[model samples]
Target: MAPTVLRLLLMLLALLPTIGLGNNAAIADTDSTPAELTIANRSIFTFHATFLGETPAARAQRATAVIEEALRGTDELKVSIDPLQNSYLVLLGNRRAFIVSPQDLEVSGGDTRVAAEQAAAVLRQVVDESGEARNLHFLLKAFGLSALATLIFLVLIKGAHLARRKLRGRLPQLMRERARQIRVGQMPLFDMQFVYRIIDRLLSLFYWVVVLLLGYQWLSFVLSQFPYTRPWGESLNVHLLDLLRYLLDGILQAIPGIAVAILIFFIARGISGFSRRVLERMARPGTLNWLTEETLQPTVRLTSLAIWLFALVMAYPYLPGSGTDAFKGLSVLLGLMISLGASSMVGQAAAGLILTYSRTLKTGEYVRVGDNEGTVTEVGMFNTTIRTGLGEVLTLPNSMITGSVTRNYSRAVQGRGYIVDTVVTIGYDTPWRQVEAMLVAAAQRTEGILDTPKPQVFQTGLSDFYPEYRLVAQAVPSEPRPRAELLSLLHANIQDVFNEYGVQIMSPHYLGDPAQEKWVPQDKWYTAPAKGQSADEP
Candidate 1:
């Protein structure tokens, strides 16, 4: 029983120094059984101990507090150890001491005095290391490294500038030589100077990127030099690497979708092109006999646009952010805006489609729409452009054209030649045969009047004072000549024919006949400046 009591006491002594007095009362509350005691900063171990009872815990707590107080002081720390009653004494300078038992030494497999001395030496070393004076050397080293980094950065910038200058001087000529080798139908595919400029910008961007990375690394290194700021440096590096990794992962994940989208784009493009080609071939004069040439191109274009729109809709879900709420909101907003703003555009497109399919008007045709009479130059989705004989180009909205009267003169000119008619009143005294013969002569003399169909004269109306002599002649079928000019020429021939035949054309309100006969004699037909062929000829 006595031996067992001794062993219990020895074990109790060994365990006491490990637990602090502040924590001894809370040992039953704590789940962790602490076997060692370390200073607050955890830079060094103070001693080996255990959680058991009050007496030794109190002694250890007091000694640790004394050691910490001594470390906080300005005086130098000195340690010594000695045997005391089968245990050991660790002396801090000449004032304070801590006890180490044989059981404590046995826990670490060492003699009691040796263990006490070692613990004292560790405490002293820790106290010295905790002093603030030693950080100056590290601070100075950090400054030196920062200065060296700055110098290297400046040197790199200078080298980059020189390299940029050299590349700018020589790259354009080389690009031009290379571009000259790539030709399409005798025209260079790409502009050499433009390509060189693009490459120069990319190279400059690369250099700036390198410079930025170097600066970031230098900054990180400088920050990591101090213990306090080292965590921030580590965090910066970790964040940058994480961001890069995330971006790379996203790119890799999106590659399949991007490939699918590209494939759809190429397929749609090929289909549109092939369909357009087929439509073009069918539009030829003697091909598949489908649509007319005037309608085929517009139909093909509209069909291609519809196909591409459908393709885009199919490809939408595969786009990187198409499923995102922001993308959805943007699409809705855009669609709303378009719906609100495109009323007139819708009307114009509808009219254009109708006009195209109806074949009421065609390009290169002479047509009169409302007050605007001209040759149709362009028929667009929204508008139609016309070039008049007066050299004015008129752009009219398709909606307006659909609402107005469109007189296509070229439509009549397709088969039979266009007929030009003029009416004149004559007195009853003049014979009808003579009047008809004179009108025929005038029609024959007109430059653009067709000869084969011949001119025909009609006495369509008789009034109280005179008879209406309507003379009609065939002109060129919608030939690109001024109608006003042709009318002027025809009128001039009629006047000369009348004046040569001594027939007075002023019979619309003939109250009485003129006394001396208001007629121009045949001899005076070519009078004065009217020097040309005689008007009396057949």
Candidate 2:
């Protein structure tokens, strides 16, 4: 029993040193267990720490490790380990915290208990210098702000779209009302109102353009915030914005030209209105003989051209290329081309101007030019247009028209008066006196033949089978339908009168008859037909 006890005592004595060493190492490493550390004056304590690299995931893991380390041991005044804190405790003494210098691991103390406890507490509270919590909080706040901004942008865009739709729905009615108001306003200021209308439309168009640009800009900004579209959005926005800006610049540059054009339009409209009124007053019955002359048309045309020319001079510099060297070069080139190719064009134009001032013909006039007989339809600067009796239109160069002989039938009288001449032939057996009487009576019987002019007959020639007699009489010019009727009536009257004297009138063409008797007086042999009996009686 004594030998066994001695062996057991020796074994217990050897295990005691190992257990004490283990306890001391565990206490030194403990950070979770509360410890009281104290420090002396002029002493600094540094807490040694290890951490994962600066990455979000690594930082998160480090935070977790620190928390785990803090909860490691339960000893109230014992030095404890906290892996989450990434630090080791250096308990000096007492309940006081130690002054720990992060730069170096040095410890000093007034008392052992206070220094140990202070060092332990200071180490437990150590934090990284990077301010990870502050950065995370800032990122969360930024995301919330961005989401709010996007929501606001969407609301504004939707509201603008709805407003535009409502405005569009009412646009037609607004236009009509504005137009009526303008029409009823002062006549002299009507042109100004028209210009205002154009400007208003342009402003509305510009507004829509700006709205679209803003919408595109907002969409691009929003897309740039998204991970998928961020890169593409940046590039797309740059190019698209550049193109839109270029378009806007071009439109801005064109404003001067547009203004000049508007001015020209207003001036022309005013002049035309005034001129039309003047012409109407002048053209009233017996007021002015020259109002219908070709001078009036040319004068109006020249006045309008002068106005346009003045406007063009003002507008030329505002055009895209008008002030550039290219414009001068183009002018030179155009001059060369015109000199080479436009001689005929110039001649035609000059002739047209001359024709307009000559007052030889006007529209709706029946004209005979060279071999073509037609009605004038239009007279242009380069050519004259005529509509032929066959319903065909002919365009003749003014130069050609100037050189040709032209007869204007309508210009001879207010209503083109004409003479109707008929020729009748009869055998030599017909008496000349009787034939003259018949022709004269036939002219008097014809409807539309003028009585004041009185009909005349002449013996034209003696043919092989008959003597040719001509009957000429004046007719009313305005009666187009009566011309043919009068001619038929004249021929029928001559036939009836000639047949009463037993003379055959050959109209298809009569050659004098050699076997027929010579001409005689109508009072000697010719007798009237029986009452109610036809001249065809034998």
Candidate 3:
């Protein structure tokens, strides 16, 4: 079994010069990620293809052990490269240790020579460092340097911490004292709370960046002090610079995409402005009845939102990383989340649009939706806010406003006012004309009730005992407080006028009839209140 293994090993070595000879494109297509070869924690180089029957990972493992063994030898090891037609022999002290094939070259030209001078340079560094690691004087010197680096790193980090803490405490006080000077009229140019938050965040970012840079320098210095890990230390610095370069390159590449996005948004903004102007022109008296002053703002907002959304959709493909799977997945995830939350929101928004476009509700108009009655303060996408005369503000969902019966009080008046109404039930024995006259007189006594259109009293219902009278009149001053005050005044006057007429305002309810007649006699037919000819009549 041992003899068979030895023969197989020899055969594998002999076959290395002729194996893995495929074209570069084919080898790269086979596996895009190459396998890395490392010594201890230090990376030496990478391999792209299989040699003989060994995979790149397997080849890396074999090369690592052999290289480490060569470095551990006591005798002086002479390292050299032997080039062949299809491979290169990496010799250590006259012994053919490993082979570098056409597949291993970082060659820009054809796979002609073993143009792995980069690999040779890396090997030479390793050999020199291994020898230095054996020196007691160098080890002591490196240890001292590492200790100094660590101490410096800690001191700098602590100083940054104290500086940040002091800044966090004092910056807000400084800003607060100085902010009063930066004001326009009475309004401050900067809200103190917002400025504090901005300052704190900026300080935190700077502090963390300083800490990270200090930590990186410390770690790199410590690693570089050791011979075995010197390559890793160098790699750390190289990789960080490479990452920063990649980021800058990406930013430069995205410039054209950003410019296109900006251009699209600019055009959309112009179109939105144009549409707003057109709507405003159409809002001129008798130009477009549907596009009135009440609806102009919302129409403009919705139009602008739609135009910007369209522009975003058109410019999506040109945005940086928009084609990446990660970007697509994130977009899909966000869409799913929105869809989950938007079920009721979409309905309410639709109802709000319906209320807006249909001219059902407008801000500052008095309205009664179900039991909620107030002036519409805001007709938002999700809710409608109304402020009542009672000094209470109510937020009703747009869906509820659309579903419930809504009565607009402003419709009955020429100018800004609300229709105020009150209901009363009186015995049938009392003439309805007299009752109406009493109500009209009461309305006349009330302040802010318009008399030109004339107050109206309607007999809404006739029950078993009495008739229901509803007195509806328009109240002016166009405010919530005045409307409430007018209703109270009207009710008070109704009682006083009825008392003057010697008429009972209580609704009569009786199971049995009285022996005497309940009707007013003919002699009293020309009574003072009849045909509203009383002293209060104008």
Candidate 4:
């Protein structure tokens, strides 16, 4: 047993030289040739030898001797017996030459001079059988190892795919159950459905990535044993990993901005809802109108704007161009543009603010500006709109309104009565006392005139043709449309009263001469009472 082991070890040692020689010869051939060389002039040489030898090495030695014998008459196939060459040469069919190195054979271009001679020698030595046996063994071993590796890779990929499918199938049902529970009780931290979907998608992505990575590693391992694909596989691995790294970086960068945007949207919605409720409550009957007008809407708008601005600032780093020089330059340019164009807008806004705080006129208030009298319908930052009784709407800039004189009739008297006055003309023949009584009675007879304040009559002017009397009446505060009606009624009543008193109203006549006497009704009716009666008997 000891001798058998020692002999086996010696045989392995003896084969080491042939392996070394084959490796060196392969390297030398590859180094000596360019990579672009085609297989155009290739040749194959087979050798079969009937060796009457006792050992395998001796048989191989006899095969080498047969190959050398075939090369003797061939000029192109030179058989060098040098120990360093560790090979023999032969000519093949006169088309090519072969160098049978220690463990491999090389073929090259040669002339067709020694073809018949080499063929005869090969036939005599019988070289084909030994070479065919060696080639068949090598090809069968390579094919078996390749088939085993492919089978293992396919089984691994198939198992991983099956596992992934099973997990994916179970995920949806579990997520549905969890979502139902959350909906029935309270809201979860993240929306249950959304979170579950995100998790499932991430898991799916991870599973595919792991599968792909494992496949790639296995392929790289298998390819490393190959002579052609080893270098290319390493480069592909680096590019694949770089792509995955860039994808991860992009996802990470987007997460914070997406979160911030969602948060801001929800928060703004909540705040807007709260503010609306508060405004509705405040706008209810009997609440302070000033609070609704001055505080609620502007506060809500400003708060919403501020929240969005803050969110934008917080998300700036995650914005695509926020950190770039172009963004900074654009910011500056936009600011300059706004400054150039916003001066009038700023002025109008300031004026509007002043108008709101001043409370000079509100919507639905009757106002008169110069000759324009109307009801205010809208008040904007830049303009105030009014609808006139004549059915015309007028838009006035805030700046124009601020510098003009405006009379607000609604604010003149809160709950007090409004005064409506009318004027009349009568001859001097009418007694001043009687005129005063007649004017007061006329105002009292008019509809919508307040009797408590008592209509007043003042002698406004005493012209040469007539004496002008002003009749003023008070109206109820709630009666807005009664002023013109009351005035018309009073003038009609005055005409009737003056006619009853026989007082001539001198409206059309101007005094042409003082000598033309205006008639006195009392002078015409002057007759002395009958004598011999009691003195007070008129």
Which number leads on TM-score?
A: 3
lDDT of 4 by residue, 104-197 (tens): 2223433222432443354333333223324667456645766777788788878877888898788878877877666634665457667867
Candidate 3, residues 306-328, lDDT tens digits: the string is 99999999899889999999999
Off by over 4 Å in 1: 1-134, 193-197, 200-211, 226-236, 277-290, 414-440, 452-479, 502-538
Residue range 418-520, candidate 1, lDDT tens digits: 5567898988888989999999999999888777677889999988877899987767763546655777788888888988778888654677767877877
- The 0-to-1 C-alpha lDDT of every candidate, in the order given, reads 0.74, 0.59, 0.78, 0.60
Give a tens-digit lDDT track for model 2, residues 1-538: 6434543543453345467733332122222222222121111233332111122233234433543343332323333321112122233122212222221122232444454455455444332211222356744664675687678777876777676667766766676676667664444425555655686676578667867776777667765544334445576698897898999998998887878767767776787778767866776668876655556667677666776677667666766658689999998998899899788888988999888877777786767788876768898889999887565789988888899999775564435555567888776766888888888887787777767667889999987777888997776665653344566777767765665565666666654554854333334333454245433555
**Where does the lowest 10-residue lDDT sum fall in candidate 2?**
34-43
Per-candidate clash tally = 2, 52, 0, 3
TM-score, prediction 4:
0.39
Q: Per-candidate TM vs. native?
A: 0.65, 0.47, 0.78, 0.39
Ranked candidates, highest lDDT first: 3, 1, 4, 2
> How well does candidate 4 match the true structure, expressed as C-alpha RMSD?
20.8
* True-vs-predicted CA distance for residue 537, candidate 3, Å: 27
